[model samples]
Target: MNKAVFLDRDGVINEVLTDRVKFVNRSDQMYFFPGVAEAIRLFNQTFDYVFVVTNQGGVGLGFMKEAQLQAIHSDMITSLQKEGALIQEVVYCPHKPKSGCTCRKPNSKLIEDLARKYDVDVKSSYMVGDTDTDIIAGKKAGTKTVFIGKSDPLADAVYPDLLQAAHWIVDDAT
Candidate 1:
C-alpha cells in the first residue's frame, strides 16, 4: 500500500492568471508559487507518489495547443527537478467543461486511474487543491482532502497555501 498526494496544478503549484480568463496558454505564463518547490521537495520525501491532476481545457477550447501545454509542463517539471523535487506523473483532462469529461476535477476518474496504475492506497492518500472541485474529487476518490487558499466546508483540512498543506501532511504522517 503506497501513499500518494494528488495536487492541482494551477493555483496550487503555479500561480493562476485570473486576468487571462483561461488556462495558461503560454509557457512564459507558467510561474510557480512561492515555496512550491520546497513543498514538492518535502512531498517527494514523504509520499510514495506525487501526482499532478489538472484540467487543461484551454487545449480543447483552442485557446492553446496540446504541444504548448506539454511545453509548459515540461518547463515546470524541469524546474522542479532542478530543485530536487520530482513529480511521478501528471494526469490531465484535455476536454472543455461542457464536454462532460469524466476525468476532470470533481470527477474521480483520473484519481482512480492513477490509484490503480500506481497501486496507491486511496484511503491514506491526500488530495490538495485550491478549489472545491478538487476537494470533491478527493472525497469521491476516498482520500483525505486538503483545500488551499479559502476554507471549504467540505474539505477535511484547510491551509493558506500548498506549503502549509505540505507541512501538515508531513507532520501528520509522523
Candidate 2:
C-alpha cells in the first residue's frame, strides 16, 4: 500500500484572509504561500501521493463560477509543477456548507474515498491542514494528522506553517 499526504488547499497551500470571511472567486484571489511549492516538492519526494482536499463553497454559493475554480486550480498545479511538485489529485466539496454535503471537511467521506481508491494505508498516511475540521476528518479517516497553526491543537502534530510541517513529515516518514 502507498503512503499518501492529504493537504488542505486554502491556508495550507495558499493564502487566505485572516478573518476567514472571504473565499477564492477567481485565480487572482489565489496566492501561493511562501515556501509552499518547495514544501510540496518535499512532500512529493517523501509520499507516494499528494492530494489536495478542499472545501470550495464559493461555487455553490454563486460567488464563484466553476470555470474560475478550475482556472485557479490549474494555475496552482502548474506553479507547483514548475517547482518540482506534482499533486496526484484535487478533490473539493463545492456544495454550500448548509447543503449537508458528505464530502466536506469535518466529514471523512472525501478522505476515506480517496484512500480506498488509491489503495493507500491510512496508518502511514497523513492529513495536513490549518483547521480543526481538517484534523477531525483525518482522525475519522484513520490517518495521522498535522495541524498548521500556532497553538497546539487536536492534531497529532502541530506547526506554524506547512513548510515546518513538511519537515516534520519528512522526518516521520524516514
Candidate 3:
C-alpha cells in the first residue's frame, strides 16, 4: 500500500480570499500562497502519492460551474508544474452543505474511496489543510492530520501556513 499526502486546496495551496458579495469562483482571481510549490515538492519526496482533497460547494449552489473550477485547478497545476511539483490527483466534493453529502470533509467517503481505489495505506498517510473539517476528515480516514490555520484544540499540530507545515514534516524526517 502507498502512503499519501492529502491536501486541501484553498488556504493550503492558495490564500483564501473572502468578499461579502461573492465567493471565490474565478480562475483569474486565484492566487497561490508563497512557498507552496516548494513545500509540495518536499512532501512529494517523502510521500508515495500527493493528492488534493477539497470541498467546493459553489458548484452545487450554481455560483460556479465545474468547468470554471477545472480551469482554476488547471492554472494552479500549471504553476506548480512550473516550479517542479507534480500532484498525483485532485478529489473534490462539489455538494453544498445542505446537501448532506457523504463526500464532504468531516465525512470519510472521499478519502475512503481514494484509498480503496489506489491501494492507499491511510495509517501511514498524512493530511494537511487549513480548516477543522479537513482535519476531521483526516482523522476519520485514519491518517495523521495537520492543521494550518487558527489554533484548534483537537488538532495534532498547527502551523501558520502550508509552507511552515511542510517544514515541520521535513524536520520530522530528519
Candidate 4:
C-alpha cells in the first residue's frame, strides 16, 4: 500500500482570496500560494503518492462550469510540474455545503474512493491543509493531520504555511 499526502487546493495551495469575492472560474484566478510548489516538491520526495482533495463550492453555486475548473487545475498542474513536483491526482467536491454530499471535506468519501482506486494506506498517510474541514477529513480517512496555519486550533500540528509544514514533515521523517 502507498502512503499519500493529501492537500487542499484553495487556501492551502493558492492564496486564499477572500477579498477577490469572485469565484475562481478563470485560470488567471488560480494563483499559487507562496512556497506551495516547494512544499509539494518536498512531499513528493518523501511520500509514495501526493493527492489533492479540495472543496470547490463555487461550482455548486453556479459560479463556474466543470470545464473551467478543469482548465484551472490543468494550469495548476503545469505550474507544479515546472517546479519539479507532480500532483498524483486531484479530487474536488462540486456540491454546496448544504447539499450533504459524502465527498465534501469533514467526510471521507473522496479519500475512500481514492483508497479503493489506488493502493493508499490510510494509516500511514498524512493530510496537510489550512482549514478545520481538511483536518477533519484527514481524521475520518484515518490519516495523521497537519494544519498549515497559525490560527487553526483543531490541527494536530500547526505551521505558519505549507513550506513550514513541509519542513516539519522532513524533520519527522528523519
Candidate 5:
C-alpha cells in the first residue's frame, strides 16, 4: 500500500489573510510561507503521494468565486513546481461550515475517499495542517496527525511550520 501526506492549503502552504482569516481571493494575494516549497519538495520525495486536502469555504460564502480560488491554487502549484515539488492531487471542500457537508474538515469523507482511490495505507499516512479541524479529520481518517503552528491536543505532534513537520516525518519514516 502506498503512503501519502495530506496537507492543508491556507496556513500550511500560503499565508492566510490575517484580516479575513479566509482564502486568498486573488492570485496576487497568494504568498507562500517561508520554506513551504522546499518542504513540499521533501514530501514529494518521501511519500508516494503528496495530496492537499483543504476546506475552501470562501467559495460557499461567496467571498470568492471558484474560478478565483482556482487561479490562486494554480499560481501556488506553479510556484511549487518551479521549486521541484509535485503535488499528486488537491481535494477541497467548497462548502459552508454549516452546509452539513461531509467533505469538510473534522469529517473524514475526503481523506477516506482519497485513500481508497489511491490505495493508500491510511494508518501509515500522515496529515499535516494548522487547524483543529484538520487534526480532527486526520485522526478520524486514521492517519498520523501533525499540527503546524498552534497547539492541539489531538495532534500526534506539533511543529512551527511545514518544514519542521516534513523533517520529522522523513526522519520518523526511516
Candidate 6:
C-alpha cells in the first residue's frame, strides 16, 4: 500500500479572502500563498501520492457554477506545476453545508474514496488542513493529521503554515 499526503485547497494551498468575497468566485481570485507550491513539491517528493481535498460549497450555493470552480482548480494546478509540484488528484465536495453529504470534511468519505482508489494505507498517510473539520476527517480516516495554523489537540502535529508542516512531516517520516 502507498502512503500519501492530503491537503486542503483553500487556506492551506491558497489564500482565502475573509474580507472580500470568501469564495474563489473567479479564476482570477485564485492566489497561491507564499511557499505553498514549494511545500507541495516537498510533499510530492516524500509521499507516494499528494492530493487536494476541498469543500467548495459555493458551487451548490450558486455563488459560482461548477465550471467556474473547475477553472479555479485548473489555474491553481497549472501555477503549482510551474513550480514543480504535482498533485495526484483533487477531490472536492460540491454540496451545500447543510446538504448532509458524506463527502464533506468531518465525514472522511472524500479521503476514504481516494484511499480506496489509490490503494493507500490510511494509517500511513497524513492529512494537512487548517480547520477542525479537516482534522476530524483525517482522524476518522485513521491517518496522521497535521493542522495548519492554530493549535488543535486532534491533530498529531501543528504548524504556523503549510511550509512548516511540510517540513515536519518529511522529517518525522525519516
- For candidate 1, the TM-score is 0.95
Taking every candidate in turn, the Cα RMSD to the unseen true structure, in Å, is: 1.5, 1.8, 2.0, 1.6, 1.6, 1.2
lDDT of each: 0.89, 0.88, 0.84, 0.84, 0.89, 0.90
Q: Would you give me the overall lDDT of model 3?
A: 0.84
TM-score of each model, paired residue for residue: 0.95, 0.94, 0.92, 0.93, 0.94, 0.96
Point to the candidate with the largest TM-score.
6
| Candidate 2 vs 3: which has more TM-score | 2
Model 6 segments more than 4 A misplaced: 18-21
After the best TM-score superposition of candidate 2, give how far the Cα of residue 93 lies from its true spot, in angstroms. Answer: 0.3
User: Per-residue CA lDDT of candidate 6, range 1-174, in tens?
Assistant: 999999998989877876644668897778777889889889888889999999999998989889888888888888789889988888899999989988988899999999999999999899999999999999999999999987999899999899999999999866
Candidate 6 backbone collisions, by pair? none
Q: Backbone collision count in every prediction?
A: 0, 0, 0, 0, 0, 0
Q: Pick the candidate with the highest lDDT.
A: 6
- The candidate, 3 or 6, that scores higher on TM-score is 6
Model 5, 1-174: lDDT tens digits are 999999999888888867644458888777788898888888888789999998989899999898888777777787789889988788889998889989999999999999999999999999999999999999999999999986888899999999999999888766
Better of 3 and 5 by TM-score: 5
Greater TM-score among 4 and 6 belongs to 6
Question: Whole-model lDDT, candidate 5?
Answer: 0.89
Compose the digit string of candidate 1's lDDT tens values, residues 41-94: 898898999999998898898888888888888888888999998998888998
Model 2 Cα lDDT, one tens digit per residue, 36-103: 88888898888999999999988898888888888888888887898898998888888988798899
In model 3, state the lDDT of residue 24. 58
